[model samples]
Target chain A: MSITIYVPADAAALALGADAVAAAITREAARRGMDIRLVRNGSRGMFWLEPLVEVATARGRMAYGPVAAGDVCGLFDADFAGGGVHPLLLGFTEDLSWLRQQRRLACRRIGVIDPRSLADYKAHGGGEGLRRSRSLAPAEIVSAVTASGLRGRGGAAFPTGIKWKTVLDTAASQKYIVCNADEGDSGTFSDRLLMEGDPFQLLEGMAIAGLAVGATQGYIYVRSEYPHAIEALNRAIEGARDWLGNGPGKFTIEVRKGAGSYVCGEETAMLESIEGRRGIVRAKPPLPAISGLFGQPTVINNVITFASVPDIFAQGADIYSGMGCNRSRGTLPFQLAGNIRFGGLVEVPFGLKLRDLLYDFGGGSRSGRPLRAVQVGGPLGAYLPESQFNTVLDYEAFAAIGAGLGHGGIVAFDDTVDMAKQARYAMKFCAIESCGKCTPCRIGSTRGVEVIDRIGAGQAGQIALLRELCDTMTHGSLCAMGSMTPYPVLSALNHFPEDFA
Target chain B: MENLPAIERTIEAIVAAKQSLPGALLPILHEIQDGLGYIPSESVPRIAKALNLSRAEVHGVITYYQHFRQIPPGRHVLRVCCAEACQAVGGEALAEHARLRLQGSDLTLEPVYCLGLCACGPALQIDETTLHARVTPQKFDALVDALEVDP
Candidate 1:
């Protein structure tokens, strides 16, 4: 009988010599004339114990953690081939607290299935929505998405269905669908994990987008920093031949790799990067819907946006919409990172207070210090003070607290952080990453750094100039880089004035 | 080529066809990068031509972006993620350390947005391998020890 061996498909595992461990296990098993079925599943999310392997027998899936090639010998002695208990054995995989408590929706299939294997995906209830979607009219699909109350997860909280509907009605035969996999936000890996661990879901979502918008082509503009995600996505595409039409107009996809610029995370910038140029934000009015990729009407959705496509159709829009507050329906996949005790990915329904995520789901600060500021959203998102932690995790809720639910990444900061410096850093970050296409972004960002520096150096008139400059950036800049760049700066300035003065 | 948006169209077509392909991103990038050598500073038009995109459309793609390198990179690429998550884990300090190390040298240190290895705390990408859990300055050095050459 073939014994089951589970090695994480996570890039870290590969880096920490997971490939070597898997190889050793196979080689050793072969040398000893044993039967071992190796399954490269996505990470179980317990990163501290990476290269964590699992063995399956008549009992449930058991864990052998932090395994390396160097530890292969000990594994054999522990009789792992025969499912022997070892020091690292954490008993049943289901009982692991990390996996049990998580209310996984976006990551439900992640770490549990081979990303590209349609059979593996289908077996695990993948594309059941797409199969259902294929039966519906394009308008029906659009309505379904709208009903789900889904919005863009790429920082801009645009409604996903509305955007699709806009694109669908935009009267362009050459419409395009672009997947923004350039997840540049800090403390966020949902996009990367989804791309790496469950690529087909994204692909399936892209296909649904194509069908909905009457588009024939799609593009996934991913960052080069995601080598594993890129590699895994490549494998996922290659492995999709079976599902791709034995027919025509069935839909097609291509992946574009970013050289490593965070600004590419911006939708327009991602478009530019895909076209073999430097990434810069574009002026909207032609709202990617009217004029997007290749001058064709484009529907550029974030990784989470595309990933949520299947869910919209799988679970009716009413059901999807019923979850969140007013317009912010359904669940959001948030990454609890940076100074958090219970850090990992959590897909929680909307309307839940930020405190639930920060304290309950996140298990408080990783530093064991009093929680200070929580930066909701990515870098551009504003830092919510402790007073506003009671706010819900919806788009409107985030906005009410002077923050954007950007990419659903909540970065925790202990009492040790310098909010003033952090604020300055946000502007400084925009200064460094801004495409320089617009004057406010190009000039304002540099000026912002200078002003913040002047303030840091105890210069007079710096704060006033900083506010004026932030206003100019917010209004004059063509894109979010300069516009939203001031969110952090302003929030920090308002909440922690002590840091500035 | 002069009109930024026209150039954007050229860039859009490079990966438009394969965008929906399951796992098609890196391959499309390899193809595009291979065809254009380094991502062209002025080839958005060429990209638009290849992919049937508009100039303004191309410009949007080019400018509102990162990761699509329009300029030639140094012989050695040193990427650092300065996102909030990384910064929280003292990535800012690590970045400063790296910047000091790369100053006045051929080593091109670029601030990448994210490499997606958040769980590893501080992560870096040298070439392709996603280097994870970089704790100390020495660890970062040794991770790139074999890669430390001309640049």
Candidate 2:
């Protein structure tokens, strides 16, 4: 019998030389005249141990990781294919504390199956949600989602059911479902992971969404940075043609690539970009639920939000809702990045404390220094001090503490970091990414850089001016781009005052 | 300049193929750029006319996106992540190294916000195909050297 070996083709794993490891393994196996069926799977989200190779054994899938091309021959000599003892052997893939600990609702199938294989996707409980949705009425489907307590996982914690309900309620001939796959946040890769790992799941979620919202066509606005994800989704779309349509209530999906504009991640700006404009932000009044995507009632959601739908339907909504705490219900895939050790995806119920995520799962800073500050959410999020590390990861909890759980991206910084510079960078990023539709964002961001520079240069009283400017940007700006820029700036000022001084 | 007719034909074909699709501008722009490396200023008029959009509108879109380069890039494009996640892990230093290394070389170095390798950064991509994570100064130099040798 041919032995099965799995190597992650996930972008993160690929970046870490998984290709080299796979190639080396193939060559070594060929030289030894051993029959091996290699499958390029998705990442397990344990990035630090990437190029994580697994071999199917009589017992289970035995793991070997942080594997390099140089270690391939050594692994072979130790009979790794037969699950023999080797220094790199990590027993079973499921046994790792990283994979074992948390609730992996959205990312359950990632790294477990061959990403390109539709048959594999189907076999592992893939199309159940769509099937369930198809059997029920549209209102019933929306109600199920509402009862699931699934909010938009893409930063804005608006209830997903309410948004779907609005689209359902709105009487429009041409409603659209736009999956906001333009995940441009610096510290996040959950969207990319979900799209690349389980393309069928996203399609199933989108199809379910189409059934509920009465949308005929769906568009996934993906960022150009994720070429692998784009390729994966396109392939999945091609393979799932019969599954997606070819009957009554036909629904179609198209993948649109975004140009390198961060502001396009904004729902209205994304709509404008899709319409082939300059990605300028549109003022809210018509609210995207009422008028969106070429002035049609649209159901725009984040990739994670849609990906969460399949599980919500497969399992009961009560099961999902029962897991989380307070207003923030269901599991959120928190991406640990930056200077943290064991940085990767941690999908847990909403009540997990910030410090637990950082120290327990992340194993603290990679620099071996004291973790000074942690930036939860994206650049627009607050730079939380060690004092606030114990803060819960709940949306309302984060919001109450003048922070946000935007996209659940936690970027850790060591003692070596300069908070003042980080604050300046937040302003600078806003300046560069802002759509220039509003004054406070476009003009204020540039002014903010100057103010930060003055402060850095030991200019007195500039701190007061900076604070005043932050207040104006916070209040006067049109969207989160300008409005939330102060989160980091003020958080840095408040938390790490010595750095600013 | 010599292949202007060929370029025009390619642009026309791309526009014709995609113009029927809803909101065809970005896809058309992507095809043009992917085919010819950069969106030629001359093709803007043709795209504008095909999509029933103004030339100014087309130009504005082409310029607004950092991906749609008006001018031709070098032999290779190296994008170094400069976002906060990467910055926390010596990405700035890596960017600096890349800048100094590619100064007079036929490689274009641009600052990308993130490449979704935040977990294993500082990350960089060469020619938008090959991504490298946990890149140090030495690794950056070695990669550049390999690129130069291969080219």
Candidate 3:
């Protein structure tokens, strides 16, 4: 049997020289008359240990990481193919503390299997959900998802079942399922991680959604920034075409790319972008579940929400629902990033304390500075102080503190961080990425940036002005892009007031 | 700017490949950019005609999207992430470094929202493919030097 060596081809992993490392390993292996099977898998979400190499051994997969091209020659000398003792050996990949602790329901197959291989996907407990969905009725599938207590992981936190139920109730001859892969949130990579890692799981989820909602076609609206993910998804879609049979009806999946706009992540905006127009937010008279994508009833969901579907069907709905807290059930992939030491993906059940995630998993700041402020849920999320760190990572819990667990992305900052600057950045980002559909968002954001500048310049009444502006933008804007921009700005001013001085 | 005939050929080929898809405008634009490095202004009429869209609509879309460049880009395009997550580390400083390094060079530097490498940032991408993380001022200079040497 040829020795199998796994090197991640994940975008983040590749960014860190994984490609070079793989090439170097291959060159050295060939020179030494070694017959090795090298597979390019997805990142395990253990980003800090990227270029995380796993060699299949009898004991299990032995891991080595943060590896470079230069390290390959030394690895060969250590006879690493047989899992021989090497200085960089991390023992078994599963035994790592980070991997051991994470309840990886959606992220289980990531970094473990070749992302392009359909056989590999099925071999590792993949198609059970689709098979189960096939046996059950459409209503039963919807109810099963509802019972699983899965909510949209696309930062909206809307109940996934409720959305599907609405679509199911609506009478439309032509319905559609749109997977929002326009993951523009700065700190979040869960969607990209899943698409690049276990794209089949996402495809399976979409297929299940199509079956449940009685939709024949599905479109995944991915961002143009992720060329690798787009490529990976296209490859998987081509390979899985046979599995997606055309009997009563076939669930055909198409990949659509978003032209660089952050606001396009919004459901209505995404729908508009997919229609080959400017990405403008549509008003909520007819929710997307009623009139979406070519004015048909559409089941629009985030990548993680779709990815979670397979496990819900494969395993029992009760098993998933039994895990999370009140309302926010099932596991959520929490991304720890920016200035943190162990910044990566931590998929766990709800109810973990924000402090525990910050200190325990993140290992404090990478710069070894005293942690000051942390922003949860991307640019639109609030900037929290240490006092709020004890808050549980629940939707309602975060809402109670005037914060959101939007997309479950937590970006940390050290004492060196300037909250006022961060607030300005929030406004600036809104101004740049705003769809210009509403006045409050388009004008308010530019004015908000100017107001912050005034406050920074010690203007007497600009603080109150900023507050009032945030109120207008929050309540009056068309969508969350304008409405939620105030969350970061106001949270910064309220929590870390001294930054303005 | 490139000649009209070559630009016409590029647009025709892209339209032939993608004109049949639903909402074919964006994909067609992307393919044209990919093939010709930028969407030539003269080819807008051809694209609009091929896709049954008005020239104004095509122009509006081209202007709306940041990814669609009217003029051709320089030899190398370096996109530095200036998003909040990256700024928490040293992204601000890194962007400034990139700006300073490419000041007199024939390289173009643009600001990107995020590259999904927040965990290992301050991150940057060179020419839409090669991504570099944990980039400091010195490292930015070294990467630029390497690019210049190779080019």
Measured with DockQ on alpha carbons, how good is candidate 3? Answer: 0.81
- Sorted by lDDT (best first), the order is 2, 3, 1
TM-score of chain B taken alone, every candidate: 0.66, 0.97, 0.95
B25-140 in candidate 3: lDDT tens per residue? 88888888988889988878887888888999999989998888999898988999998789988999988878877988888899999889989999989998898888889988
What tens digits encode model 3's per-residue C-alpha lDDT throughout A1-501?
A: 899999999999989999999999999999999999999999998788988999999989999987999999999999889897888888899999988988888988988888999999999999889988987788998999998888999988888888999999999999999999998998999999899999999999999998998998999999988989999999999989988755543789999988788989999988888888888889997999999999999999999999999989888897678988878888899999999999999999999999999989999999999899999999899999999999999898999999999998999999999889899999999999998989999999999999999988889579999999999998999999999999999999998888887
Candidate 2 regions off by >4 Å?
A: none
How should the candidates be ordered by DockQ, best one leading? 2, 3, 1
DockQ of each two-chain model: 0.34, 0.93, 0.81
The estimated TM-scores of all candidates read: 0.86, 0.99, 0.98
Q: List the candidate 1 regions with Cα displacement exceeding 4 Å.
A: A81-83, A276-278, B1-76, B99-110, B146-151
Give model 3's docking category: high
- Where's the lowest-lDDT run of ten residues in candidate 3 chain A? A242-251
For DockQ, the strongest prediction is 2
> Model-by-model lDDT, in order?
0.77, 0.92, 0.91
Once model 2 is optimally superposed onto the true structure by TM-score, how far is the C-alpha of residue A366 displaced, in angstroms?
Answer: 0.6
A243-315: candidate 2 lDDT, tens digit per residue: 8886644789999999889988999999999988889999998999999999999999999999999888888
Alpha-carbon interface RMSD of model 1?
4.8
List CA RMSD, all candidates.
5.6, 0.9, 1.1
Give residue A391's error in model 3 in angstroms. 0.6
TM-score of chain A of each: 0.93, 0.99, 0.99
